[model samples]
Target: MIPSILPTYNRAPLSFVKGEGVWLQTEDGRRYLDLGAGIAVNALGHANPDLVDALTTQANALWHVSNLYQIPAQQKLADALVERTFADTCFFTNSGTEAMELVVKMARKYWHDQGQPERTRILTFEGAFHGRSSAAIAAVGTEKMTKGFGPLLSGFTQLPWGDHEALREAAAQADVGAILIEPVQGEGGIRPVPDQCLKGLRDLCDDIGALLIFDEVQCGMGRTGKLFAHEWAGVTPDIMMVAKGIGGGFPLGAVLATEAAAACMVAGTHGSTYGGNPLACAVGAKVMEIVASEDFLDGVRARSGRLRQGLEGLVASHPEVFEGVRGTGLMLGLKCKGAPADLVQAGYAEGVLTVPAADNVVRLLPPLNIAEAEIDEALSRLDRVAARVGSDAG
Candidate 1:
């Protein structure tokens, strides 16, 4: 039978009936190590006890109260986020795409309210994946995702990634209002923007009066062993988009911004029907609570070092298959010399799940709280899969 859902995902012939921590269980009772963590959404892992309790508690008490009135859970979540990050205000949404919609609009609105309405041009880099929204496709405008999806949304400028000279030159343009970037491009293949480069971009944006937006939708929420990925570079964005792990697998997203950047976004100017609902806010607040602690984050860093070392060893032992490992914390990618898809398929046979990206990279995004034993298992699976891939390619 044909599926009812649209053919959007190139899904594998795998159906997981249940999951806990870093493992998934198929209906036939086969177990698989889940390194993708639902593409970095299951920050604390599937069916997390605390998250379940939070959702259940809210569900019984209140679910959806319209944004027409106050929602205390939403306020508490907003306050928690504001207290820890560079943002002075937090606006909730349903997904990364919605968060991005607000982000682009907020940037443009910032300039418009200041009487520079023509400053709508935003600078985006190559291989950037914001979301499938119209604004997102328009921002990238690349053949990969934006193909046949036009007359594309205008007012975006594309630039080569990591070209500092070009970055400065683009920022200096009169019509530019913002530069949107990911601190570590996840879908673009776990590419981490160097610290100095991020610093340079910050300075350029500050000098040119353009707002800096970090789309941390994939790399935030303690996935990078920090509250947000940009914190590693010690660079802050004027506006930040967060999702995925912040909801800990729930479909909740948020747009965070400096007080100055959000000044024009009055109550009536923007809102969501289901966003900031009591149910989602309660769950998100619980996620933020668990992920925002110093001790928890330190564990993430320790695990990251362990995982990175294991991956490096795999790269050394399988030179024909892998180049190196990239990315930070539990969010990592293995650069393969051959097709990443091939490696991913081979991984399935090894009873491991992974995510594929461009640049022939396979992503490994285990839950932030994955155990040392699970890390060892993932490394063993990678070792076996790498050997199989290398042999098959021969």
Candidate 2:
């Protein structure tokens, strides 16, 4: 029996001893195809050669250095991020939740610095999963995540997901300082915001002078066949939070913003001790080098089509089990008409791994460099799982 840890996670029974490429191995040596990719963190797959090399090299060198001194690796990673994206400035963090907290603070500070102290209300969409922190829970406001947590943070204003009129009206409020949204809602059920909706929000934010923020923690880092999900909509956010795939599973997150938007965060206004540590930055730099390549992104787009077609075929064969498939690129979700958790368990038993999300959706987050044959193999296992579950339901 496993040791009793905290009751935070309702974990599956299986645990892997090791992993490589798209396969995980149990201690007893049973192999399983990993489609969840550690909930979209392993962009380069488990035990990737480049990532292993970077981590080992950095481990031999310096590990921790306080933020008081200038770190070259941190500066290098920040420069690369700024060059490739709309962000003119970058602030590092240890996790996506921390990055989001910094973004909220930056948003409020922006208005305050501009002499509009009352412009502190931040508008967020319903069904959003910012994080688990107090500020994040307040921004998300989901009953499951916020039920026992008393007295939610004061500055957040929750709006319905994808409601244009409500969002516009909220933006028109003089007290509204910023609008935060996930370009693709991950935990809220892998829903991609319509491009037209994003464009409208950008126009509205511009008109009302409210900063637009995208929580790209789950959908960014080439997971959506692009470096950032907002690129598909052609609308740039004033501030964006990215994590999960940013470090290729090394616990790194960042808040990127245009200089003007981040100008409010002056010295000593906010900071983190291990935010830009050398080891995390070195690994992050290597991850960016590999993921930001044209060939890697092209392969991601090509493989995404393969996975989508296979899922579509699976849905066609087992319509009673699955309602449909949604989402873009590698961050796809299957809408399960039957029990999603049951299907996930069935997949695990069939030597495959999948993740369940809200709205009864099963998420498939394969590695960014997954081969076509691996996609076919995963689909075969999914087909078997679907057939078994469908027969049981019948």
Candidate 3:
């Protein structure tokens, strides 16, 4: 029998009823350390007081005065993003998938307005996940993402990850209008693109007159110890998709673009009814105010270093289970010798939670504001989980 909700996800058996900071309380009252942070959505941790206050305050004042009229909260968030990053304008959305839709449309529309309508193709890389939307699935072009969805949206070319030669060859083509990639692949196993590679992508886009797009939905909002992962490379994308932590668990996403890139979007090119509602933008603004600060980012970097070092030591102590540690800031991943799902299951046994990603990796995306003591506790719990997994394997 089909469940009340769609059974699309292979959900874990655990049922969490409440969350506070980096911990979740199961329905039966068991507490579990949340290292995944709701897949990086709860950047400030579950039920962050500031975010809760912002949402409640905005909810009491106003909730849904759609894009039909001006919204102050939306304007405030847009201003903050513009001041903090490279965007000249921002379009809000309800999720990363909606942001992806705008990114594709904006990139192509720029060329169309410039009298180059044929330059419609956008280049993406393997192991790239933009979103699950038709355009996003088409952009990835992987059999895993596009198998059943046929007659997919055209004009996206998939390239091998880190293949500069192939990237050069593809970008040189006349029809290529843009290049989209995740600065650090979250679902592709928390792989960080080298700084030089990001710089090279920027140079390549400049040379070919193609826009550069970054999908920062998973690695932005200070998850990478920088405001955005691309900032570590000191390069800026012409268009960027941002979400996840930006709302501090509330659903909000945005497509930020340079004025030149967004010139063609005019008034009716794209929009959403529930996108930028007062409740969402209020929470997002608060998240931005906190996460974009130097003090907060410094804390994130410090915690990231400690977590990374601990993960390395953990891997060394349990070589039979773990292979290595990779990723930046709080978005770390543990490469497993066997299926990462097994490690995730072991984490459950140890009253810890992790997210399993591609390439046999168990992701550890704890709250960016996780305290030092919490870090130590998380490491201790992870050590126990590793020991149990290793013993079982032996």
Candidate 4:
């Protein structure tokens, strides 16, 4: 292999030539069940006909248009998001990190606009993965990700995951402006904050008059059998960031907020060039149409049951490899007792693709539309990999 242009991202040896539905084909014509789904971006599956058509149709019409112009597709997608969720306004971005950056600005700017500029501190959780940008990294500035980044950004505080006492203390402080969290911690090994805990946080935020922000970059959309993960807790966030599944593999993200919370972002507040391009919005609109349907969401719940049950059965048979299973719906995780990366590699070799996340867990983010037979096939491959890895460890 030739040297790459960028040193970032440890490249996997296998290169996929084509993908359809929940399967990927390598250059050598070998097929593999793709449980990872491009880290949960391919919500409708790879090369989905509807998404492809939407993209191609829009590409022939218009590809790039500045935010200065009236983009109908952008408005349509935003309308869909608002109609389905608690947000009354929307801001588009090119990726989750950018959406998060906008969120940080919006949260702080809200307090600043209200004449309390000193209340700028944003509370984040330990082991949370926001993104790689300066502000996003600062929000999640633990030792692992912030070692090389000099002089972490100010006005961000960290607390242990699910620490109610710490959260209450921080919220009580006058400097704290908002609380940011992932309803289900995606990169932190699919650790889901309890539904009751989410409700408790909502109540706390309400009492403190602090905004509650949910980073739904990974666990939102249909992945959690709900339009948004917070819906399960019967709580709504003041501001939410969504990406990954919104574009159905296209680069798109959005910040959704209530009318009062979003009022601070007035004219000349923020902007993005390719944030709401017609091409991406066309595809995103289609994705929203499909994933937001009652039937589609119900199917996600049903499929989630089958997948979780299969994984639990796998764990029962191969306890040495997988200690437990966690997370909700299609965004499931296998807590690996052995080497998670090794297990991922073994699964790849056995014609299955899995993603390795933090906490020594392997994530399964198969397409929301994956069939029952494909689920069975993925389970069989996992069984083989688990047996092999377990035997070696034994």
Candidate 5:
């Protein structure tokens, strides 16, 4: 029976009442350690004081104002984004899919303004997950995402994941205006494209005069300990999309681009009513302040090392459940031999929350600011889950 809320998710039986730091409380008062961190959205963790303050302060002052009017908070957030990243311009959105849509438009229009309207093709790879929107579905036409959506949007070409030769040939082709890819694929079993490969792709795009777009929507905002995942490769894209942690749990996303790449996006070309709403921008700005600090990022790196070591230990201890662990910083994945969903259920029973992903991988996206003690507690819960899984298999 379909409930009014839409049965899209195979949701766990648990219903959380409230959250604080890296913990979620059930209505009946059981506390669960939140390793998922709302799929990497809660960078500062649930009900963060700074973000709460930012939201409430803005709510007291103002709420919704159309982009037609000058919004200082929005501008402030844009300035912060531009100052920290490679983008010369910023466009706000309510979610990652919307930001992705804006980027697609910007890329096609940039070539159009240059009188090369035929160059509208975008290159993506296999095992990529963009978003759920139409354009996004077409951008990443995985069978699971495109089953019902027929006659998918055109102009997107899917390349084999990690095939450098194929990528080179495709990049050399005409009508290829832009190349869109994720440096660290969040939904593709936590696969990270090698650093040398990113450098090669960047060089190839530069040679072919194609705009490079990095969908850092899942890997940005300190999820990888760096400001963006591409920072590890030291390659910057002409355009980038960021969401998730940028809002610290509030819905906020942004499309960032170089001035030359965005030159064609003039007035009346595109706009969003609630894209840069003061409320979203206010919280986003505070999140930026906290995540952009070197001290905080350094701490994230430390925690990542700790988690990696602990997971490696788990793999050794419970070879029946896990094979290995992968991913950078807080965006980790435990490669499971058993069903990932079953492991997630085990975690639920042990008072820990984890997310299941493709390739039998269970993801751990703990908040960037999670405490050391919480990390130990989460590991303890995972150890218990491992024992349960092993016992059941036996």
Candidate 6:
């Protein structure tokens, strides 16, 4: 029997009624420390006052004005993004999936406008989760994501993860016009592509005349202690997808591109009706203003260091449960020696919420502005979860 809502998610039994900062209160009034931060969406913390104010202020003034007309809030967000990052232009969207769709179109259209329509293929890597859209699923080309969705969108080639030789060979192909990757793979278990590797990708793209696209939807907006994860590598993508924390919990996304890369996307090339609505852009502008500051990012780094050090200690003390830690900044993952789901269940018992990802990892993506005391409390709660996991194993 199908329920009123889709049963797509194996949702936890508990229902959260409200959230504040790094804590969520269940319907029954139990408080749980939110280490996942809604899968890295609530970067400033749940119900952030700044974001709330921005949204409400815009809601009172204006809400929806289609892209057919100019939107000041949208322009403001675009200007903020352009000022803070490598993008020369920005196209707003409602989610990362929409951003990915635009990224593909922009890349292929660039070649088409350049009189090379044959160069349509884009290369992606294993363990990559772009989005659930047909183009994104096909870009990843994973059986898990594409099993039932046949006759998938073509022109995307999937390469083995971390196989530089394969990547170089694929990108050098005449038909390959772009390479898409996640600077920090959030769904693929919080794997941070080494700085050197990102640099190499940039070099390879330059040599092959292929555009580089970064999916920063999960690791951007100060999650990696940088404005974006690719900043840590000191290399910029020709096209970048941003979402999740950009709106500090409000649904918003953008595809940012260099002028050269976006040249082909003329007036009618792309657009959206609800994209860049006043409400979303207003909130995103506030998030950008707060997160793109050096002071805030430095705090993120310091907190990340403390949290990473504590996680290292946790790994040492719980060898039976955890293998190691992976990732940078607040987007950390615990590589579990056992099933990561067990650790997640244990965390639930201890009132700490976490997210499980591929590669036997449990992700800890707490709010970027999480307090030092909250960090200590989170560590203590995680320790209890680890102890509980050890007990269950014994």
Which ranges of candidate 2 are over 4 A from the true structure? 1-4
Worst window of 10 by summed lDDT in candidate 1 = 162-171
User: lDDT by residue for model 6 over 305-334, one digit each (tens)?
Assistant: 999999999999999989999999999999
Question: In model 1, which regions exceed 4 Å deviation?
Answer: 1-3
Superposition error at 354 for model 3 (Å): 0.4
Instruction: Tell me the lDDT of candidate 3.
Output: 0.94
For candidate 4, the C-alpha RMSD (Å) to the true structure equals 1.2
C-alpha TM-score for every candidate: 0.98, 0.98, 0.99, 0.98, 0.99, 0.99
Taking all chains together, the TM-score of candidate 2 against the true structure is: 0.98
- Candidate 4: list runs displaced more than 4 Å: none
lDDT of 5 by residue, 1-394 (tens): 7799987887789989999999999999999999999998999999999899999999999999799799999999999999998889999999999999999999999999999999999999998988999999999988889998889989999999988888888887889999999988998889988999889889988899999999998899998889998989998999999998999999999999999999899999999999999999999999999999999999999999999899999999999999999999999999999899889999889999999889999999999999988999899999999999889888
Against the reference, the lDDT scores of all candidates come to 0.93, 0.93, 0.94, 0.93, 0.93, 0.93
lDDT of 4 by residue, 268-375 (tens): 999998999999999999999999999999999999999999999999999778889999999999999876898998887799999999999999999999999989
Candidate 4, residue 91: how far the Cα is off, in Å: 0.6
Q: What is the C-alpha RMSD of each candidate to the true structure, in Å?
A: 1.1, 1.4, 0.7, 1.2, 0.9, 0.8
Off by over 4 Å in 6: none
lDDT over C-alpha atoms for residue 360 of model 4: 95
Question: For model 2, how does the per-residue alpha-carbon lDDT over 3-58 read when each residue is reduced to its tens digit?
Answer: 67867888899989999999999999999999999999999999999999998898
Superposed model 3: Cα runs more than 4 Å off: none
Worst 10 residues of 5 by lDDT: 1-10
